[model samples]
Target: MRVLVTGGAGFIGSAVVRHLVNDKRFDVLSIDKLTYAGTLTSMVSVNDNPLYRFENADVCDKTAITQAMSDFRPDRIMHLAAESHVDRSITGAKDFVETNVLGTFNMLECARAYWQSLDSRAKETFRFLHISTDEVYGSLGKEGLFTESTPYDPSSPYSATKAASDHLAKAWERTYGLPVVISNCSNNYGPFHFPEKLIPLMIINAMEGKSLPVYGSGSNIRDWLFVEDHAKALDLIAERGRVGETYNVGGRNEQRNIDVVNRICTLMDEFRPEHGPHSRLIKCVEDRPGHDARYAIDATKLEQELCWKAVENFDTGIEKTVKWYLENEWWWSPLRQRYKGERLGLLPSGA
Candidate 1:
């Protein structure tokens, strides 16, 4: 089968593309705008594969998207393109709205037009899988987990834009009978991850003996999923998920922000022992604006319906992630140079 994967050069997107190209034996046409977070090196493992093709284009461009749809003639379209950094979104929301909301609208329209032109058999098999985030559910209380039915109360500009896109996806399915499925996943960390995010930032920072910044008291909680496991879940959902249904994917591993950093420090100390304790570098910093207290996903729907579960829990996943960064400096060094582990998402003084 052929798959057209947007943002295939990104962290999670590249993982999905790599899995499809290497393990699933599917032809992949990757369309990406190559933004700061999107790097071609993420797909270096499968760069030479004959079945994997790359296209440098923006999803917001209707003409480019339509042409890509016509040229690839894919059976499935996995949409993973967007400005995904929450801190970046806080500082600059226009890019997030333009890319996440308007860009998704353009993709939906292009996919709908293409689906309409296909034969009955091809149309029946076509799927549009929108990959999203659990952040759209907003901050969760310490007691409950976020389910597919959870009401959206997005706390950040990033999650708000994603929420808007999720609405658009479901609305198109209802109004135009588009074959679309949505998956809201938790925080993903593994190989090829940009250094701007928490895990990578901390890892790189600790390695360099730089101060590891922890926001506030570092009590915020988040469910962490390995990128490869998330890729497997995405593939399964795209092929078998019910149209118009939303599935939540998670690691089933919830961790407090400070605890996570401590774990990373412990692991780094074990793997690469330094003169002083790695934890000593931990520094409490100002928290981001509108920071969610906690986020946890109830992925039962994805597990029961699609027979998909995250294979790597927090312990195994974080170890592997740390090792990947330690071993592959070539992959992350450039990113570190570009983005030195810094804090983001500060609320304006008066606003």
Candidate 2:
């Protein structure tokens, strides 16, 4: 299979590309603009492989995207390119809309055009998978999980753009008869994660003896999904999933933000005893604007229909993530230099 993955250099995108090339041995083309959070080095594991290639391109540029689609002639397109950080979006909503909303619109048009040119069998077999976040469902109370049928009530600029893109994807399928499948996933943590995210930031900060910032007393909750498992779910959803359906993929692991930081501290204490009790570095800070109280996904549809199961829970997945950062400084050192641990998402009064 020839699969074209946009944003293939970013955290979750890179995971999908690596699985496609190294495990499935599919001919994969990764198109990325090398944005601040994306680095080609994330795909080093499969870059030299015969089945893998990359193009430096932007999905927001419809002409470039259409040209690449024409050239690659991919059987499957996994649209993952987006400005995905909620905190970043609070300060910079325009970029999120341009990248997530406009980019997805352009990608859908490009995919539809390409699908039209394909022969009957090729068109029937083609798939466009739109990967999104569970944040689109907004905050959950302490009771229920976010099922596939939950109405979207996005609370942040980042998730609002993603919600718009999700709607566009389904509209393309319904209006233009394009074959599209969507997967909204929970928080992902594993290797090659960007340092700005909660998990990696804590790991790297604890390593360097910097303060591990926990926002809003750390009571906010998130369901964690191992990135590799989410990648596998994407593959299955694209391969055999019914078109015009949305699947929720989650690791079934929920943790309070403070507990997550404390767990990381405990892990650091085990791995780097010389650091001597990392929990002392925990520092609670101002909460983000419109921070969701909780997010938990009910992936029963994906689990029952697609038989997808996450292999890593919070305890195991977090241990693996911490170890990866501990062992792979070569991969993260340059990123740390560029990001300097400055806090993000500071909003002024009277919006």
Candidate 3:
């Protein structure tokens, strides 16, 4: 299969690209804008593969995206590009709306045009998969998991835009007859993760003996998924999932923010005994604006429909993630220089 993957240099995107090229041996065109969160270093494993080609383009550029669609003649399009950091979105919602909302529109229009141009058999085989997050469902009441039928009640600027994009994808399918499938995933932590996120931030800070910052008493809960597992789920959804269907992919590993921090500390203590008792570095800080109390996804639909299961639970996933950072200093060291774990999403003094 020939696949065109957007944002294929970012965290989850790179994982998907690597799996497509190395595991499935699919002909892949990896397109990315190389934003702050996107680094080419993540795709080094398969960069030289003949089946893996890279395109440095933005989804918001309709002309460029359309040109790529025409040139690549992709049988499948996995749309993963967006401004995805919640903290960054809080500080800069315009970029989120522009990229997530407007960019998705461009992708849908381009996909519709391309889908319309294909032969009957090619059209039947075409799939446009839009990858999204579970944060669109807003905070759960500590009782229920976010199912495919859950109403979207986004709490952050980031998630609100993603929710908008999700609706757009469905609308394109319903109104334009574009073959679109969406997947809403939970918190993802694994190798090549940008350090600004929770797990990586804690691990990097603890290694440096810097203060490990936790937000709002660190009681907030998130269902964590391994990125590699999420990559596989995306591939399965793109290849075999039903059109116009929404799938929730999760690791079923629910962990409190504080517990997650402590677990990283325990693992660090094993790897870097000199940084013994990293838990002592934990420092509770101000909560983010409109912080969701909890987020968990029900992957029943995906598991039953696609026969997919997350291979890594919280403990195993966390260990693998921590060890990756400990061993691969070359990958993360440069990122640490650029982003030093400073607090983001805070309003200026009295804004």
Candidate 4:
């Protein structure tokens, strides 16, 4: 089967593309905007594979995307293109709204036009999977997990735009009979991850003996999913999930921000104890505005309905992630040159 993936050069998107090409042995086309977060090296595994093709294009440009989709004529369209970094979205919300909100609108419109042109059987088989974040449900209290039925109460510009995009995908399904399946997942950490996010940032920073910055009291909690496990879940949802249904995918591994950092520091100490304890590098900083206290997902729907489960717990996953970074400096060094783990999303005093 042929599949088209948006943001295929990105962290999670690259995992999905590689899984499709190398694991499932499917012909794939990855359409990505090649943003600062998107590195071509992520796709090196599939670069020379005959089953894979890539188009350097943005989902915001509906005309170009529509043409690319038409040329690809895919059996499935996995919409993953979005400005996903919450800190970057705080001050840089324009890109988030434009890409996540407006861009989703364009993809829905294009998919509607494309789905209507196919024959009856092809229409029946076609699927458009909208991958999203559980952050759209906002912060959880000390208890409870985000379920598919959870109401969206976004706290950041990033989550707001993602919530908007989620609504748009559902609206298309309800209003136009478009076959749409949505998957909301927890934070993903694994190989080929860009260096900006918390896990990788901490890993690299500890390796360099740089102070590890933890926001506020460092008590914020998040359920972390290994990216490859998420890739497998996405594939299942795209192929077998019911249309107009929302599935929650999570690793069932919830960890506090500080604990996650300390774990990494311990790993670093083990790997290179000559540098002293990495915990000394932990430094609490001003927290990002609208920082959610916690985010966890209940993947019962996905687990029971689709017979899917995450393979890696946070401990196993984090170790693998640290090892991957240790071995793959060639992948992340250039990224570190571009972004030196600077603080982001800080509001000016009395703005």
Candidate 5:
């Protein structure tokens, strides 16, 4: 099947592209804006593959997205493009609103028009898979997992915009009869992850013997999912998931913020014994504004309905992730020059 993947050069998007091109050997057209986070080098593995093609276009561009949809004539449209960093979103939300909200609105409208133009068989087979996040469900207390039906109570501009996009996707399906399936996933980490996020940030800082900043008391919890596993789940949802339904994909592995950092440190120490005891670099810092206390996804619906299972738990995934950074400096070295481990999301002193 032919698939058009928006944001196909970013971390999770690249993973999906690699999986579809290498594993499924699907004809894939990757459309990305090449934002600071969306680097084409991430998809170097399959960039030259016969089945893979890429276009440097922002999803927010109605003409570009509409043209790509018309040109690719894909069986499935996987929408993964957005401004995804929480810390970055806190500092500048306009970009998030523009890309996540407006971009998604455009994607939905374009896809609806394209679907309408297709013949009966093509329309029936086409799927618009909207990738989303668990953060839209807001902060969870110490108890309970976020189900597919959880009411949205977004804590940050990032989540708020993503929630708006999710609503737009569902409304398109309901109002316009667009065949859309939504997947809200937990935190994704693995190879090709940008250095700004938690896992890679800690790993790189510890490697440089820099302080590993832990926000607040580092008690906030998050459910972690391997990026490759998420890529597979996305493919499954696109292929067989029911239209207008929501699926929550997670690794079912929960860890506190401090614990996750310490784990990365431990793995780093094992891999680079010369830089032993990396945990000593840990330092507490003020938390970001409206930091969510916890987030955990209940993926029972996805598992039972789609027969999906995560291959990597936290321990296995972290080990592979640390080793990837150590061995594949070729991919991340340039990114480090562009984005060092400086703190973000800091409000002005008076604010």
Candidate 6:
């Protein structure tokens, strides 16, 4: 099958493109805007593959998106493009709105038109998969998991924009009869992750003996999913999932922010003894405005319906992640030079 994967250069998107091209034997047309976080290096494994093609284009550009869709004539459209960083979203929301909301609208409209132009058999086989996040469900208390039925309570600009896109996907399916499936996933961490995120930032910072900033006592809890596992799940859902249904994908591994950082420190100490007591660099910093206290996903629906389960628990996943960063400095070193792992998401008024 031929697949058009938007944001195919970003962390999770690149994972999907690699999986489809290398494992599934699917022809993949990767369309990305090459934002700061979107690096082509993530797709290095499949860059030269016969089935892989790359296009540097924004999803919001209807002309480019439509032209690519027309040319590729894909069986599936996996939409993963967006401004994803929560801290960055807090500081500048316009980009999030434009890309996540408006970009999604453009993709949906273009895909609908393309689908309508398809013949009966092709239209029946075509699918559009909208990838999303669990943050749209808002903060959880000390307990409970975010199910597909959970009402949206987006607190940050990032989540709000994703929530809007989610609605647009569902609306298109309902009103336009588009073959659409949406999946809301938990926090993804693994190799090729940009350094600005919590896990990568802490890993690089600890290695360099720099201060590790933990926000607001570091109690915020997040369910972590391995990017490769998520890519597999996306392929599965896109192939067999029921149209108009939403699936919640998660690692089923929840850890507090501080605990996650400490785990990284312990792993570093065990593997690279030179980084002694990495936890010593732990420093509590001010929390971002509207920071969600906790987020956990109940992926029972995805598992039971699609037979999908995350293979990596927190311990195994984090160990592999730390090892990847240590061994693959060439991949991340340039990124560090560009983005020095500074703090973001500070409110303008200092609320």
TM-score of each: 0.97, 0.97, 0.97, 0.97, 0.97, 0.97
- Which digits, one per residue and each the tens of the lDDT, describe model 1 over residues 1-351? 999999999999999999999999899999999988899998888999999999999999999999999988999999999999888887789999999999999999999999999999999889999999999988877799999999999988999999999999999999999999999999888889887788888888889898888888898888889999999999999999999999999988988889989999999999988534899989988877798988898999988988887888889889999999999999888876665434351111100
Show where candidate 2 strays beyond 4 Å.
Answer: 341-351
* lDDT score at residue 312, model 5, on the 0-100 scale: 91
lDDT of 5 at 196: 74
Backbone clashes in each candidate structure, one number apiece?
A: 0, 0, 0, 0, 0, 0
lDDT of 6 by residue, 1-351 (tens): 899999999989999999999999999999999988899988888888999999999999999999999999999999999999888887789999999999999999999999999999999999999999999999999878899999999999999999999999999999999999999999999999887788888888888888888888888888889999999999999999999999999998888888998999999889878768788889888777898999999999999999999998888899999999989899888877775545462111110
Predicted candidate 4: what Cα RMSD to the true structure?
2.7
TM-score, candidate number 2: 0.97
TM-score of 4: 0.97
lDDT of 4: 0.90
Worst lDDT run of 10 residues, candidate 3, spans 342-351
Which residue pairs overlap in candidate 1's backbone?
none
lDDT by residue for model 4 (136-244), tens: 9998999999999999999999999999999999999999999999999999999988787888888888888887888887898888899999999999999999999
In candidate 5 the C-alpha lDDT for residue 195 amounts to 77
lDDT of 5 by residue, 1-351 (tens): 999999999999999999999999999999999988889999888977989999999898889888998998999999999999888888789999999999999999999999999999999999999999999999999899999989999989899999999999999999999999999999999999987778887887888898888888888889999999999999999999999999999989888989998899889888888988999989888878899889999999989999999999889899999999888888887887775545562211100
TM-score, cand. 5 vs. native = 0.97
CA RMSD, predictions in order: 2.7, 2.6, 2.7, 2.7, 2.7, 2.5
For candidate 6, the per-residue lDDT at 204 reads 82
C-alpha lDDT (0 to 100) for residue 245 of candidate 5: 97
Error in Å for residue 285 of model 5: 0.5
Error of 1 at 221 (Å): 0.3
